[model samples]
Target: MGEVKVVFQSVDEVMDYLKALEGYSGDLDLQCDHMIVDGKSLLGILSLGVNRLLNLQIYSDNYEELIKKIEFCCRG
Candidate 1:
């Protein structure tokens, strides 16, 4: 699995991020504190609260393409 921290500045960003995630066949999840939700679900991602860095867990070894697609949203 691969992990990264990302932040959604607006609803559009969230939508775009979800779109990127949906293209991948691997499992993707977003976590906030003790809460975890499906990354591809618009409602699930919106429920995580905005303007905060979220922990993204990509559950697959062959997730390089997916990661590259969403790297713009990731924070170093």
Candidate 2:
């Protein structure tokens, strides 16, 4: 497993980030406070109340691709 720290400027950015990761072959989880939610789940992400910094854990075989994609999405 690998980790990356990201921050979303707005609710729309969070939603868009999740949307862009659609069809990714591995598991992704984002944590904030004490909450952990599925990165691929828009509803779960929205429920995360994400604003500002979020910590992400990428549990995937292709850690490089997952990190790259996540970084691209959350880059603002």
Candidate 3:
């Protein structure tokens, strides 16, 4: 699994991120505190909230494209 800390600047970006994730057929999850949601789902991502640190877990070995799409959102 690949893990990264991410922060969404706005709802639009979250939508874009999800769109980018759509091409991948893998399990991706976003976790904030105790809440965890599917990375590819807009509603699920929104539930984790925005502008906060989120732990993104990428379950696929082939995640270069997905990572590239959200690299800007990475926190440090």
- The C-alpha lDDT values of all candidates are 0.86, 0.74, 0.83
Q: Report the lDDT tens digits of candidate 1 across residue range 1-76.
A: 8898989999999988877766577888999999999988889999998898899998999867777898879996
Sorted by lDDT, highest first, which candidate order results?
1, 3, 2
Poorly placed runs, candidate 2 (over 4 Å): 73-76
Candidate 1 has an lDDT of: 0.86
Q: Write the per-residue lDDT of candidate 2 for residues 8-40, one digit (tens) a residue.
A: 767788766877677877788888888988877
The better-scoring model by TM-score among 1 and 2 is: 1
Task: Give the runs in model 3 whose Cα sits over 4 Å from its true position.
Answer: none
Position 33, candidate 2: lDDT: 86
Give the residue spans of candidate 1 off by over 4 A. Answer: none
- Top of the candidates by lDDT: 1
Model 1 clashes, total count: 0
Pairwise TM-score winner, candidates 2 and 3: 3
Q: Residue-pair clashes per candidate, as listed?
A: 0, 0, 0
User: In model 3, what is the error at residue 76, expressed in angstroms?
Assistant: 3.1
